[model samples]
Target: MKAQLELLSKYSGTAIEEIEVLFKDNPRLQSASVLGVNIFEELKTQINKSQVLKELIVYINDNYSVGDKLAPEREVAEILGYERSTIREYYPNLKLFGYLDIQHGKSTLFKRSFEHQIIELVKL
Candidate 1:
């Protein structure tokens, strides 16, 4: 467990500190140090390229779990390293991708699709 955190920490480098600050709120992540760091670090990279949503798709791929509640667009924005409005702006398209099922300010997901050809819509 510690070793996994260490490897994940390696991926964060300068970003570890930021993730640590966010970690305080998510105690379940106490031992999994690297996961949050990697998420934020990778998110920054993705947002810069306008591929933030795709990055989230990849994230759900790495952490496969259904019933994920993507709410508080602020948090989703934080994960994507973008503004909350950006998530709203592209939300319909996200729904079209089948990764997101949004309604009434709540976002539910079918993460399995992200496991394969998730963002292949652009290619098609």
Candidate 2:
């Protein structure tokens, strides 16, 4: 976890202290389940309650100006202590909401426009 936080800190210019609010805030990110299996609903619950998950979203969103690239789901899962399959299951929602895009042979990209929507959602 320490190493992952360090990696996240490296990716984002803001230190952990500066971005603590992002982690502390009650961020509720959700979407309709594409698979119709309630997986997203389950994962959203976890993400909403987990500071590490919220930090991952915020760190990527906050660091987007530096570059939109994101660490893959597998790496993020390792950091957040979730299964890669769980991360993979939740990815469709992220993509559906435009928070992330997966490119072949390239790192995922975080979308700032969608991130703005997320910020607005959090404000509500």
Candidate 3:
């Protein structure tokens, strides 16, 4: 752990004292360290991007119909409490699954009913 901290300090330019303080402050980080896992990597893998996609599907199903125009990415991000980039990241997935039609310089449109796609998303 000392070696790991020293390497992290060397690469990140963060003092060992500051890194120790961060570990002391965040229980999750402390736990990850104790388990010999990289917390940053764990955090990246643990972000439920599919869950967010499922949520967007449900939101579209509940609020919009086929051919109906959807809000811009920024507005949808605000409504969903996610970064616009995150929402945009999943737009292609939605399009591939036949739920949405995303076009450059145009509002996204509901391409089809996503009620059935919810089950598919759960399997992902």
Candidate 4:
């Protein structure tokens, strides 16, 4: 467990002390660390540009409804055939880009405005 935390700390560029606190205090941070690492590694692999983004958009369109709750990362991963670690990598991006809004300890809410923006960006 210590080693995993250490790796997560290093991967996230966070101090070990801070990560320890997060491990105990905030489960989200732990999930974030693993997700961050997956995203970093995925970017490194040089897969086709926009592929993940496009796929994510499609997934969002297919699964989410405005004002509806999103499933947990584990369930989404099962549905998408992706690893939970990999699926999490996109969650924050969706939020950051205004595609989704997360409510702590509650399901994420879809933001419909992002649908068009994501489609436009993916086209380029």
Q: Judging by TM-score against the true structure, name the best candidate.
A: 3
- Distance (Å) between predicted and true CA of 84, model 4? 0.6
Q: Please state the error at residue 34 of candidate 1 in Å.
A: 41
- State the lDDT of candidate 1 residue by residue for 11-66, as single tens digits: 64635455556555775775555554555455345435556556655555555466
User: Tens digits of per-residue lDDT for model 3 on 52-113?
Assistant: 86667666777788999998889988998999998888888677656688888888999977
Candidate 1 CA-lDDT value: 0.56
Candidate 4 local lDDT, 17-73, one digit each (tens)? 878887887777777767666664554343235466566666777766777777787
Worst 10 residues of 3 by lDDT: 37-46
TM-score of 3: 0.54
C-alpha lDDT of all candidate models, in order: 0.56, 0.55, 0.69, 0.68
Using lDDT as the measure, name the better of candidate 1 and candidate 2: 1
Give a tens-digit lDDT track for model 2, residues 65-90. Answer: 53467777788788668788866675
Q: What would the TM-scores of all predictions be?
A: 0.44, 0.43, 0.54, 0.51
Alpha carbon lDDT at 104, candidate 2:
75
Q: Report clash pairs, candidate 2.
A: none
Clashes of each: 0, 0, 0, 0
Give the distance in Å from residue 105's predicted Cα in candidate 1 to where it truly belongs: 4.0
The clash tally of candidate 1 reads 0
Clashing residue pairs in candidate 1 (N, C-alpha, C atoms within 3 angstroms): none
